[model samples]
Target: MSSSANNAVSSPFQLFDRTEWKRLNGHFSYHLSQDEVDNLHALNEPLNIKEIEDIYFPLAHLINIFIERTKDAHAVVNGFLNKHTQRLPFIIGIAGSVAVGKSTTARVLQKVLSMLPGKPRVDLVTTDGFLYPNKVLNERNILNRKGFPESYDTKLLLNFLSAMKSGVEEIQVPVYSHLEYDILENHMQDVVRPDILIVEGINVLQVNSSKGNIVFVSDYFDYSIYVDADEKDIMDWYVSRFESLRATSFQNPESYFHRYAGMDPQESLAMATNIWNEINRPNLQENILPTRYRADLILEKGSHHFVKQIKVRKI
Candidate 1:
């Protein structure tokens, strides 16, 4: 290839300012309503239609391109094998530090991507469901390490992914209740085959080894995103989200964190800070942050939890 042609290909980790990224959205239409945006926004996190147009609209367009590319690749492989094969769900993994607004990002992506033409089916599932039951965690004496990768049942998560990718018509996933802060063993969330699957979690990009064997949750992912932000900003968001939850979900009588709801604001703030410093900060530094470079795209957030820059991994 000539030098000019070679230069046309972007190197990995190529960065784009918001304006530059927004230009890519010209090919797609934005069709989200205020009510839809409101339903998707996380408590204490700010996401507006402008943010969607600037960030996610282009992202959905990019993913749509990838989906089409995947179909072409699948057809080629099927032709080479002289057989017909079904197109499985395209898995998109979203990873980020706690309280960095990844859940909101996932919901926004699911909503926007579903609205795109082709009538694609999209489903969002968090890795929280794969967390070990509290009884098991307590038995293992790691209740305090709940969000750590070790707290998850990786084998089960892998099986679920495998089933979903194998075109299984119905797969039952464990249901986790944030209000109760535990896995509802008796309850199951059904994944009726979707065209797109968004798996959002802190450790979605993690490499796991069991019984001297290696497996990565991201191995099944066709596309991946990591939400990035300054650690201090994330800590602030964490404490703020904790406070908001105290006023909301924690107020429920059955909430595991219900005790926090009655605490004085000062006490609650201190406790939230302590949790951030002791649990989440360490997990982010040790595990989550290290995997950011692995994402196909990264949305770096700024003040008030707004995405300020976008990074697209080059082909």
Candidate 2:
């Protein structure tokens, strides 16, 4: 609390501008085709080869270093214990507010990491699947709080992560459908002994201690990223994405939001704004934003949705 003490305080992260970070790309020769990059982009988010080359390639390189070092450390520890064991999958958690482009970052990393020297088996999973079913939420009277931490089946998700880290050969994860805006009862995603697993979600970095739970969702992550931007920018992006989806996916009769398809642009904008202010904004401010500093890496984005700065947490 003194002046000297205050002066001693410093950021835990080493910040890098776009040019500085791109220079760290080093000798890594990996490149994704423009078409492949195009497919990795999320709706209302722009991802081009330049972004991939400048931001993601260097990131992929850094992760590769972590992977190799982790394997080495495992071998050293096993030797010290005089026991042999398989290396567990390297898990990365990507956390951010809705419309902040975390999903696109996860997908891009999964692609780039898979292309690393040995073509490691990389799988990406979203925590959306871990969300409680719509019926459950409706019964609990928290259907509007769908993305909040309590809306997730935390125990099940913890067990899944536990099994995966314990070297389980296969695990079946429940699948959630955005079109239906609910968990699909019959569908499941099989994650079978991947070398690397990327978990992406708004709630991934949250620490919910109210349930008397000691272990957190992020505890299993070997590396974590927080996709960050100003709150106003994120809200704008959310509104834009909602309008785009209303024009496309919401037109499907079976889509949960199909009723929004007939709304005029102004109506759609108002509805999206209301939802953002009422639900997403509160969740972001209270839950998600507080966890940003916990990430090992932070991607700070500009209003145009391009990453303008990178922050690497000091070792």
* CA lDDT of each prediction against the hidden true structure: 0.90, 0.94
Compute each candidate's TM-score over C-alphas: 0.94, 0.97
Tens digits of per-residue lDDT for model 1, 45-148: 99889998888888999899999999999999999999897889999999999999999999999998898888789989999999999999999999999999
Off by over 4 Å in 2: 1-9
TM-score of 2: 0.97
lDDT by residue for model 2 over 1-315, one digit each (tens)?
988666446778888999999999886667677889889999999999999889999999998899999999999999999999999999999999999999899999999889898899999999999999999999999999999988999889889999989999899999999999999998999999899999999999888987788999899999999999999999999999999999999999999999999999999999999999999999999999999999999999999999999999989
Candidate 2: clashing residue pairs, number: 0
Instruction: Give the lDDT of residue 120 in candidate 2.
Output: 94
- The segments of candidate 1 whose C-alpha lies over 4 angstroms from its true place after superposition are 1-11, 209-211
